[model samples]
Target: MKSKQENITIISIVIVRRFICFFGIAIIFVLNGYAQINELSIELEIVSISKGNYHPSPQELIKGDTFPKRIDFEFIVYNNSNKMLMIGSNTRCYYHSDGKETNYEEIGRFLMINGTDTIPLYTDRYYLHPNPHSSVKAIWGIIDSSKDFKACPIFTPFLKRWTNVGKDNTKELYNYLKSSRFVYVPILADYQRVLDKLNNKSIIDCIIYPRNTLEVKKKEPFSVFVGYLEEKDYDYIYPSEYK
Candidate 1:
């Protein structure tokens, strides 16, 4: 269980992490047959994000330490692909140091869609150490996964609840994890990082550098879906002054 102070830290970390786009590097593993690539597009919107404190379920804790709490992020996603993209919640977590990400782990999951079948994604209430260093300062990215259901391809980060809270939209930190109120994001670029790697692998990974702070401004209420295909992949690559 986390103490009240720790809860605040957890929420702060989540909000900070949201600013960083999680990169999906190809997993270094054996090849499994590649799934047919269908036109896939993702849309996301985070309405409200806030932090709070709570206790862990295990009930075992250090004498002076409380369970870590987490921030709750209320967000939405859409899948505008030609074929159905399977998305699950349990996503990946990465930490950064000196402008590079080093710590990576797959924590929990969620399901989402391109307006086909909508789902909500939440985070576990308890705060897991964002990093090992005491002065840990870095952004995080939530990468989606495809391992929830067997043979489903599992598009990581499909919006779904990861809380044990009974049908309640508003829940405390501890109950959120117990009831599965968390969610995840899919990593289209990092297909090779899994235990079974995909066959047809070409690095489609991208880094978006918005020209000015005002360039990629969000028009609130709705979501924003950006598309990027590497220069070599397309015959005629559109030139962007920002890049």
Candidate 2:
């Protein structure tokens, strides 16, 4: 038999090894749980055009010079998971223009019309619970005419429409606008700890914005409308002409 002192030392070594193994296993479980908790699944579908108009402001219409074309779209968000997901009040969605680095913000205050009542998109925690889904309508684009050098002047007449063939007339422009994808960032209740990890990263160089990795499966196809000014006659014109 081993000496009493030697046996004590061996027992202590065994306890330490078991403790380390338990600790490692625990860590792995924790990380795996984190990954699952952070995961989100949802769907987004562009339903229809809510409004299409060209006018920076009502007061500026007298000048006959419209710089920005505004177009609004109706969209639906469907919850694909069995569990309820929470979207914060300040949640924002961005449109990626033809996979370019430039991103455009979805206009604030998307209203949900529920027959007699109208609800704002943002809530303390927009609980997307199970199957049903939510509908929201808001302005999607405010494209500036100045961005395209070849763009026709806002007040250009219909007879001189041939001169207006530029960036707006290209199939690439239409495809670019149509192919634009939206990235939505919403806070999830189970994955709140992910934000802490983001905070630990280098804040000075990185813009840390958290977005859910919910695959947006489209149930319906959507169309885009281009807004411009059209002159009906030499003396009369339509301020908001959508095509």
Candidate 3:
């Protein structure tokens, strides 16, 4: 048997590796396959955005060693399903954007089509996410997964970060998002396990993005649901301004 110290060391190493997995492109290996039926359809939107080096420590709201030059964002995700969902305390969304742009190149990871341009996003909001991959707080059973279920909307706020954005051009990034009509996809997870009512086997993953399309249409004033994309928008073509 291993000594007490060795056991502790092994446990600590496992924890470190888990956090490191979320740090970069390593997240790609996680399989969030598309599951149809009573799974869940999420409606996501960006509430507010600000640029600075926001440190969570006392008196360091705008500058820190970890996020020295980053863009911070707030998102509201609604379950939008009739059935109750055990939302992972860490439910979050990552913006799927044009990777060729200098602004996005600096952060996140590549999602494979529209996701091809998606970068990983970290929000400073929602402190409930301790084990972002496997920790479910059992929160939001009242979650409005669908208006059909609950007429009113129920949501959770998740503030995330994208560090190393060119601070000077933060406004430019904002403008491009508006012009290009950026898209977002939810990264769902839970601590214990959420059953896939349709699949019979409990699964931690589900897929939503239309793999072939870019430019998920802006839903409502904030953005949610599937929308159309003109063919002109794809295949190296872009708005005249972007060209």
Candidate 4:
């Protein structure tokens, strides 16, 4: 019933609407891809012995016994995307040496700073909320957590007195320091795996939801102090200097 000119105009309107919708969808896809590629940036650096306070002094040296010291590994995570990221407390540190890989699961206690409050990452359910352009530091170490003095009540006094005498070669601390080469430490956001799997699911009621993917910003590894070995000196530096 419409005129030829009116029909042509209607068709043109439909075509323009379709083109606009298609263009908007394409822009969303591009932005989403960019966000996925660079959601979070991670940088790792070795805190020096002096800065980390892990080296011991001469007064704490014991004769003929191996002293235990912790080597600190620091992780700086930055949220590069606009969306808020949820980093799980299940963070892990990997040490690569001589084609062999050793994993150190969250050792001692690590903290996450969100705004003014410092949240401790000790429990299994803890989550870090790093907003856009915000950064958080997660500190881990090669300290032995298996030997709980409280668990061994009978040997508590003896263990406390002879802390520097016993060395567990099978533990993580021994293997971490034994490597002569530069330790390749990678701090991974293990929670990202959960986020990847929940791409299509509704995470509103979920206790732990995924955010942006954590990316490594720096290509090179950051160096840190391992240990000092003096010539003919059997005593090595302990992480904590005993007065």
Candidate 5:
């Protein structure tokens, strides 16, 4: 893992909440025994990263900019409804564990930064145009990945957008993806554990923040292989935060 950086800042949006109510949710579901999920999905994908304090771009860089150490990822939403799902104007991310709610001061935060120019990048925070309010506010937190949990994610995990199989939009959003039916929100790291000591090794956990959307009540065993980050050898596994 990389060393800890004293210079940290509170991000604008915090996305993590563990709410278990009563609903069964899964990344993949079948309708009438056919394999497919809902119209939209909030999925997670792994990315290999180097340890350092860096900014994704000159625009993203601020006073105390540092690459998130724990979790860094972007949430992509695919709309197969053949229609545009209106993006919302608000978002909230407050966490709770075992019935204990945290105060506003306990709200976690992370800097949203892209991994690479892997694809065209877009963020709801900066999406501006005819309707600035049209953007997906990625609200999430460390909720149990159990379907039995009353509150779980309803969206499924879609494959990489650039891939041909699930390739819904490789060239859909030419200029601003944030304004399109598909949205990408990058959740940088775990601010709650920001001050924790580094593992002092080149290998550290690389978690892609979330893999679903909407609060649900379901219990299904998920999260086993934890992905790891090391020198570009690309072999992987890190602590599975989803379960």
Candidate 6:
């Protein structure tokens, strides 16, 4: 015959052990699911590019010339299919020149905008390659050494040959940009939120303004995860601009 106090203590211990075991099992199941997700794969392509901001005339920065602080450009993306798609968070852009590929560090993230008529994803902006149309644009904001510019150059030759690179290059320029595809894995938390929005119908577009050129081609296919929209409705005004 056990006393009341002793019985209470024994019961408490049993409950505690059961809780610990249950928690451990839950953790294991979660890990196993995540591992399976990592094994999945997807394909992405740049469907369209619109005319953003074009300079009246290309500006040149001489040894003693002063350059503008920032430039703006507008580009649109087309998801290309009815299938609801997620931008591979791991994709990165790779820039190659001077017998090497440079690095393009990510400076911004993605945005989701539910417009009055359309749903569009506006990507995070980067400090590299702000204005791709600038002939004299410096690859990196800093021009300490010419080697730094190896990857940042606008690929003037490529652009000259393919006028539609900014419009319909996905089909015509796929071969040249084949290496353009790289790991586009989304950030962890973001990837989960995006994955939850399955079976959406809309165009997934990311607007990117890079500050560095050579670095763009040297990395994998990376774009800000501007969320998906209703394909039919896609317009959002920044809070500052909203009236």
Q: What is the C-alpha lDDT of each candidate?
A: 0.28, 0.35, 0.30, 0.38, 0.27, 0.30
Candidates 2 and 5: which is better by lDDT? Answer: 2
Which 10 consecutive positions of candidate 5 have the poorest summed lDDT? Answer: 154-163
Residue-wise C-alpha lDDT for candidate 6, range 59-89, written one tens digit per residue: 6422222111121122222233323322321
Model 2 RMSD in Å is: 15.1
Deviation in Å, model 1, residue 122 alpha carbon? 9.9
Cα distance off (Å), candidate 4, residue 222: 3.4
lDDT of 1 by residue, 1-243 (tens): 999999999998987776552321233111111221112222223322121222335665433232112222333323233322232222322211132445342333343323344333333222332122222111222322322333342322222232222231222322322333222444433322431242433321221111111111122333211122222222221122111
Task: Residues 28-113, candidate 4: write the lDDT tens digits.
Answer: 98787576556545555443222111223556544434432323345455555444544543323211123233442332234333
Question: Stretches of candidate 4 above 4 Å error?
Answer: 1-37, 47-68, 91-127, 130-143, 147-221, 226-243
Which residue window of length 10 is worst by lDDT in model 6?
Answer: 138-147
Per-candidate TM equals: 0.22, 0.33, 0.29, 0.33, 0.22, 0.24
Q: What TM-score quantifies how close candidate 5 is to the native fold?
A: 0.22
How many clashing residue pairs appear in each of the predictions shown? 52, 0, 21, 1, 27, 40
| RMSD to true structure for each model, in Å | 25.0, 15.1, 19.5, 15.1, 25.8, 19.6
lDDT of model 3 at residue 9?
97
Off by over 4 Å in 6: 42-47, 52-243
lDDT of 2 by residue, 40-110 (tens): 33333432221113343455443323222222333334333343333323212222124453332221233
Give candidate 1's error at residue 71 in angstroms. Answer: 4.7
| Alpha-carbon lDDT of model 6 | 0.30
User: Cα lDDT of model 1 overall?
Assistant: 0.28
Model 1 lDDT at residue 174: 24
